[model samples]
Target: MGSKRRSLAAKPNKEPKLSRTDAPAGLSPLDWQRGLRRQFGREQAFGLENLGSEPFFSEFRVSNPVSKSSYRVAIRGRGPGGNFCSCPDYATSELGTCKHIEFTIGRLEKKRGAKTAFARGYQPAFSELYLRNDGKRRLHFRAGTDCPAELREAAAGLFDLEQDGLLPEERFGELERFMAVASKSGHEFRAYDDALDFVAGRRDADRRAALLGQVFPSGAADPKLLAVLKAPLYPYQAEGALFAVKAGRALIGDDMGLGKTIQAIAATEILARHFGVSKVLVVCPTSLKYQWQSEIMRFTGRHDENAVRVINGGRAQRQKDYALTDFCKITNYEKLKPDLDLIAAWAPDLVIVDEAQRVKNWNTIAARALKRVDSPYAIVLTGTPLENKLEELISIVQFVDQHRLGPTWKLLHEHQVKDEAGRVTGYTGLEKIGQTLAPVMVRRRKSEVLRQLPSRTDQNLLVPMTEMQSLHHQENADAVAKIVQRWRKTRFLSDKDQRRLTCALQNMRMSCNSTYLLDQESDHGVKADELAALFEDLFADSEAKAVVFSQWTRTHDIIIRRLDKLGLGYVSFHGGIPSDKRPALVERFRDDPGCRVFLSTDAGSTGLNLQHASTLVNMDLPWNPAILEQRIARIHRMG
Candidate 1:
């Protein structure tokens, strides 16, 4: 209804014969969405429900339900193509493209029951402006945007320039013409092309040699120090920590399994030792409190009773009276809110937040709690900075370093996070934020270091759908479908009935995955027994040691009892473990060699070296891949 006149397009007359796939009159039907549970690797706030009903064409607005901001990220061929997004990520020449764009296409496909170029194979459909015209020239103007002769001259100029040294170096730019037009706003072509040129120009780029040189440098920081003691520091780790210390506040963002936690802790330790700080306040999820405590003690080894204090859990009485002495006082974020005033009195000289992504939303209770942590020295540790969204960056940076993003969240969102295109360089507020952040945010991708790591053979264990599960899942789905159909035909349902219906659906799905505690009395929903059977196999694996992981601790309890009945030597870790008990449990598992398995959810399994257990199993998949990696990294790491 909104847009009328549309045309199929590709390099001028190369438009594929107009078909259903093409947007009709600039008005396109909503496409069906596939699971983006992997791309951005977080639960998308804008799912199929937010997919604009009218259609998608050149520029259409889709709002993020969580942040309530409308993002215009259309994939139509005209305007900016894959290079389009109103968000600032589209602005940065360094970062290319936004995750929100990939997310929307999935939701769009789900709504329309049609295929998106993205869902099918997004890479091909990505913006192609900077790709060598034939994937060779290294630069080319749009086929018709310039006369063929003008294009030839520009392309030659870029090729010729690449052979010389007229430019300093950056992403989102081609030889010169591309940089002249390329904006640093991510999700655009210039960022990729320009980055290729700039980074390529840095020596012959013997990456393996460069990386190893950094890690095993001459006359650097002490290697035997507790933090760098276990696995020696890579060059990037040492550089990232020092960079953040200089900037006052910054993100130590090495890729997952690249030792971000170690870097942050080591930096804090260095600061404390150098500055004569007495205490440290470490805030994290209610789940990973023990991790912070364990890391502090393991790395700092500062032999002070006050070296680490866990302020998390319902131990308000103890947390309130907790003393600080050159140790980390680890606490879950929830406690940070009610105990904010008390923390000031218990002020540790330094504060650090791990997996800081938990504070990515300013409105959350976690944010409210961590913000009040007053310390001259603060460190933020995270692996995936964007998680592919602008708001996540806004929320995280605000928590990590206030100065980098400025003070108020509103101003940052307005001037730095908002979607903007058709600007001077084609970057959005978020892209601007990234460019500003990159200098301070020390990030080294595993790709850059992957060559040096040992070869890891990845295997996907595709377990078949269980018999009862296959039967009952379809049964419940059919029932829900009928209810939805009935609702469509008649609006006569009572409010109480509708509320009951929604609750029933929610419970039905949860019960299907794991029915260890399924209440036959309460659930008018489907019950699948595979989950119970799986728990049986897990704890009953008497001869083989395995790690049992779950996203839900509620379900984890059911698993714990089942394992206990089997009389297996096992331990459980979650946000609940006390700091003192946590390390001892790990030691017992290691030294006694009697403890065969470990049970943990996302909270307890991160940032620890659980190298004792050999077999790892995911009882459930968390929404974020980073979470799963953090869990596995506990065991599958390089020393």
Candidate 2:
């Protein structure tokens, strides 16, 4: 016991450095060329990696251009990384230090160097940190670092060899491991040099296919159902879908119109079939909630009169309670937060967050609400998962499956490669996850298959503001700016105070004609006039059928008057429109050419297709980009 205590006090066996778990020392550029000349003669060769063994510093030389005795040294390491051959300048590690690697290669390359980032395929046995010759700490990475059980026998063998001070098999093994680290360190530095040459750009379809193929290994998929997902998988989508289900939480990241919704739904259906899962919960933007419910019924052929239930009525709690009894309930994100407890308690087999990017704010009410329920599986749907910042993807991925990728923001971002302009030029885990997830995910782009879609024309009709509107707008704009600035400087506020601020902003914008007339409920006279004029033009003749969309009840009232003035029979539709009256409005507009105008708001924008009218005007543009897309989708989407 005394000896053990004394030994323990002396020093725990100096532990080996575990790779990257410890931050690497500032790896200043090493004078590879000059250092190499000092270590070896001028005959050593230069290149990437000689074989696969750790790269060694190649000792090569070129006679200095200016002097006979003077020599330019080339010291390049041979290891797991690549190679960095340096040429020197006045600075100790300058010129030859591979600035190209730091500047260009750094863009595409991960800080993990080249050899270790792909390490998830195996586990490391132990992670130990040790000081290097420079008194800086370094990490040594080996497989199985996290092994719970210690190999005492192996440690004893290593200890015995150390005591003997003679090289043995164990010594050789340890030496090879150390050399491997050294080689990777230098090689990764060198690899950076070549990486700089490849600038980031949009990946061609072929590359995406290859990457998807690499992600979803053959026969790794285990899907639950055979629902009809959007066609033309392009291999990547299939792999991504499967990976999402397998990982328990994942996002289908195809671009917009690329069938992310379908892939997500299919993955959920598959999970339901494969795992005896009977219930799924889809939370999406309010505009897409109903759309999801309808699509789920259509693709799964489960469109029995009561097969899919959309939570659209009553208070959010009531809808959430109703969802508790319905195995598969579709709802929107706004309601998701308030009802998360109920949703999670349902223990949904699948919880799919469509337009999942909206949940990017980890601290929002929506995010905080997600903690209430348990979900065995989760899927995030987004076309631009890494938009604005990679953290957007991080929050989303964390919501779906905590461990699917490495559990931290740093690990996820470490795998990201961006171009000079910072778009997500390349990704690493997206493919690896796809390999493990293809059976469940099915990502695809529509451009690959939809040849019949018409060219979308967004005419920038730059109309000048009406004079009265312009004057009101300028006055209101100044007030709004002032309020915002004051709000920023004046801190502390209650929830009520915050709401007051929000209302003030709304009023400011409305007073200035900055808001859509539909949103201008606090009574803006200018909006009233705008609505009246638009409708008079819309119903100049009885045959001129049109749909007027506004968020403001006041604007709807204005529209009603102009319609009354034209002696045109028109119907008003809004969320406030009685549920029984909604269908009447739709029927009247469809059945009667005399019903010259259909006035409604965002609430009237779904479940009812209005392709009968060619001229659709936005009385007020919605702030939410998705709402704008959805509003147009009701009219322009293929029937």
In terms of TM-score, which candidate is strongest?
A: 1
TM-score of 2: 0.37
lDDT of 2 by residue, 1-639 (tens): 355434335666742332332223453223333233233322223222222232222223333333332322222222212223332221122222333222222221333443443232222233222111111111222222442223323334343434322223234336334434534432221212212211111122224345435543452342312223533343444555566655555667664544566667666655665556677777766545556766776666676645677776567655555545565787776776666556655667777777666566777887757644466567777655555555555556556544333334234445667775656676666566555334333445545545533434232112224455566666656765665676678855557666766766555444443334424433334444544544543343345566667666666676676567757777877787777777877888888878777777888667868767645666666789898777776567764
Worst 10 residues of 2 by lDDT: 130-139
- Displacement of residue 380 (Cα, Å) in model 2 is 1.0
RMSD of each: 22.9, 22.3
Over 569-609, each residue of candidate 1 has an lDDT whose tens digit, in order, gives: 77888888887788887776666655766777777765678
Cα RMSD (Å) between model 1 and the true structure?
Answer: 22.9
